[model samples]
Target: MKKFILILSVIFLIHTASAQLYIAPGADLRLAGNVQVTLQNTDLINDGAISVPATGRFIFNGNGNNQISGASVPYFSELEIAKTGTGLLTLANDIRVAGKILFTSNLIDMGNFYIDLGSTGYLDGEDENSRITATGTGEVLSTVTLNAPSGANPGNLGAVITSSQNLGSTVIQRGHQSQVNTHGTGSSILRYYDITPSNNTGLNATLRIYYFDAEKNNLDENTFELFKSDDNVNWTNVGQSARNTSMNYTEQTGLNSFSRWTLSNAAAALPVTGLKLSGQWKNGAAWLEWITQTEYHNSHFNVERKYEDDLNFFIVGRKNSAHPGGNSNTLTTYHWLDHPLSNKGPVQYRIQQQSLDGATAYSNIIAIRPDVNSQFIVSMYPTLHVKDGIYLKTGGLQVEKMHVRIVDMSGRLMMTREMNYQSGWLKLPQLAGGAYKVSIKSGDHHWEGSFVKD
Candidate 1:
């Protein structure tokens, strides 16, 4: 409070003193070792210092609409800091600052900081504190200022830091990119085990399987599910991501693969190893498998199935208990039959591995067949297995002339050819190593999705 009074007193004295140079808008001014200002202009001044007297103050009043800039190459602010080591400058209203503000001292000491004030600007660094605070619905964005060493490592595509309330530590560094797809349409995931929990129960924890690329943004769209376990093997697909774009996951590509499963209870899993579930499913029953090559928490696990076509994986059957595991080397397996599937055409099947904490994990889809089915007979002839030019063929579909385009993951069109094939097969090209989209366009029928050349 005393400092504030003294600052105000100085302003009162400056307004009552005999000013040398008056700085208003559009006036030209100059200064050497010492010069005064009562009024000045908006344009810059040639190389010179406009220093006020040791006991006096320099007031730069732009009246809120003019600029007071400095001249000279890489020119600094005209009113430098600590000019006399005792002089002070009071600016009225908000002023724009450009260029480096040099302290000039071994270390700047004794100053105050203010904002939006021109007549009495804040004394910077006087409090020995500096901060970057945002106002008025403003957001402060974080960045990676450290650059990877060139040649040492040009760049890497993965999470540099990941933390949560699930595992032991709050940070984990993954790989080159689990998300890298032969065709860009596929998704990637990186799992962590260390986090800070909201409660003692593990079910309340978050599972952040993240992807940090323009290609990995789909994790934001797709549903994130928490597959549970007592033993790490045989996980059950328990829940979904609340923030998914398309909660109705008809299309797998847009689902939020980054899942943060909140365990409903507190279940210790320090003894488990095989903690992941494969999403691939078949017929009415999807696959539920875990690779608990290590174990500690030796709880029994069950495979449950659900159908989004109607309801979720109602309980199907339960599996028995397993050995409390360790990470050294242990692998476990548990499988069960799924029941009450969608009677309609094709119903989705997902395995939810449940833990004591009420945590869950949904296995990949295993398209279940109703006892009878037709194999895709999907024979890519002349055999796409070989590098020989790969092409799309719908000549037998009785479809008319159409345009089929193949695009790489980055959404770049790779191969596009007009197809007039009315009978057997459509000629295509064997694309470079990676994923491609074979989109068939005919009138209103347009198809686009992910495809692998091999």
Candidate 2:
């Protein structure tokens, strides 16, 4: 544990036995203005405070697979990654960059950690071969204030926005994971952008999304069209105003509000619309039913079910589309019964519509506690919001306490807590903006619901 304070401009280098420079807790490492600190073939473990002046630069370069991990996040004025060979920089915690992130060589694998760029920050030298990527749930976020901005790409996060009205404080988040829609999952490219503005309405805006060919995630770029989503669970096709295949970007205009956006195949449609799922207990069995407003080129519908403890959904049954070959403009209903239910706690169900073209889409999930009394009910309010907490209410049930568990879409447990309940507001953890499942259990009654953090 060593404390280093550099007030004078200097170049600091560390060559250690473990190839790691450790800044222990309570230690302070400060860089003077105009200082440049470079770590070559080394990793950084900073559990202490590290401060860099506005003009200081912190560079990580070498041929080693290095990592930055600690209880404390490192804030830098300028950060550079110039690793050679197959070496990459990985983040074990979130980091903030105020000046610039110079990506000269390989990639920065952000695994469940974020890279926050200040208002003046921007990415530099990022190309098809060298850029930021994520293997898990991580993102790169930038906040900037724009008034009638023209072709402004904040942090170069790849969503170039142009508008004739003031946007005020805007937040742009770039993630590497594919998005899920009313259809099952994996319906988008590896890149998606979540854009939020303080002044959201009445402003006609044009957005141009830029992407690297390597980030297509096996999708055909020629069919890419712009899609926008309010909850990231359901998407609406915002027709592409223009596109450049050679330049690898798509543009859309006439947008009044902004939210989650991504590119997907324009021809890839499930051919079914207004899908709804519901379930109830009937004659000692769980009766599930679904309705679709319109169907065209629909092949079949797969009924999928999962229990409270299940990590993945399994196809329980399949029903052929009412109009498999022809088109149906009227309503179509399908039903399935789960006899002799094994799990009495809680069960969730969804419908997957498969078209003749082999495309798929999903329906909203419905959960039911078959064993609970008819009068007992559990509900969560504001299922989608930008707030930090969600309220849960147990109606008709005198519940004193309950156990709650929150898990990400990947089934990774994010948090677990016990709270006194009847109706209460539960404070959520510092979760990244995405969809999460919350499970609550009290005695024999169990409930599962999902929410989106915008």
Candidate 3:
């Protein structure tokens, strides 16, 4: 018995049904060396064994639609799709590319199958007009190992990741379908990325998600926000660090982990507009006022204040919205008088307008220097604590009783109690380890501070 090998090394043009390439069950076709094979206006039907060299180039180009249907999955070293007219390359079965997939003229529709770009494989020449798309539950996948990658775009899947720590083996899957959350309300663009890394925590990663304007799916690009989901159902707004509408990408930093990510508008759009803050030194206090030109679904307003030299802002007071239940087109004004116990330097203030669905927007900050006599001073000892209690010190003006309220970074009220005005330890409810804000209120006096819970 002798073995025969069918080798194709030229431009294979099969324009008619009789000229299509078909391999029987027992036939074996082996392509070796730097073979360049082009399938022009033809279908590849392979039911036998096919071997492709690592340096071979398989080009699919024609003026009509083509399909690759066979019993065995076709593995290619390099695949190129340069279709003309009303033509596209459709995958009838799963395909694996070891080198690269070049999209030049048309789209490759992965119908219920995958186009696996192996570890070293990637995509090139993909643009808004020519790219991979799918109408079914198909995806383009790539797996690569990264160690402190900088602008590393694996498989050209469009999710560029940068980090300072090793990401280990990372798997990136690109799907072209609008993603809906668990509640089935919000939707993303036509593309989404499900990225998983071996070292998914403490990465301090920065992710830049790229997309095409054509895939916006009727979304406003100006309001795009990066959303991440652990289960691909419940999504959280990770926030956009920067965005370039002309370049078609939204970036986010300070990510501790990686997961399913997509671009979508916020659950509830930020509904405050024309926010302006103004303050003045009135008598022996700082009189802060803010106004909103229009508000929708307005829940409340949080007055945040901080010293000019401080790094974090603390919520000093929260005011209920004038039109809490409905939209307001008229101007709404809010005011707060701050009586600081000590004036270290100039103070800055801003208004955080919160919506019913937890969406928030900030107003312009206004700074004011107070020229008042110090009446009382309050400070918290052991700003960073591991225990459930912290000490508070009050000096100068004496009061019999004072009210203390604690809120988290998101302005959620955590604890509130009435404490005696003295230097003593205050017990707190068990709180998760994070940063929190503390506000103390006495007759004609207000103080604000922050602490970290370990």
Indicate which candidate wins on lDDT.
2
TM-scores for all candidates: the values are 0.25, 0.66, 0.58
Q: What value of lDDT does candidate 2 attain over all alpha carbons?
A: 0.81
lDDT of 3 by residue, 1-454 (tens): 1123233311233645534566668877777799877888877777776677888888888888888889988888899999998788888888898899988888899988899997988999999888999888789999999999999999998999999999999999998988864334456788999999999989999999999988888888888888777877655666799999999999999999988888977534335555678989778788988877655577888988887447899999999888748366567788899875353446788888777887677777887766533433345767886478888866656578889999999999999999887778999898999999888888877777888999
Reference-based lDDT, each prediction: 0.34, 0.81, 0.80
Between candidates 1 and 2, the TM-score winner: 2
lDDT tens string, model 2, 162-241? 99999999999999988765555446788999999999997799999999998887888887888777877655667688
Clash totals, every prediction: 94, 4, 0
Evaluate model 1: give its TM-score: 0.25
**Residue 369 error, candidate 2, Å:** 14
Off by over 4 Å in 3: 1-13, 267-454
- Model 3, residue pairs in steric clash: none
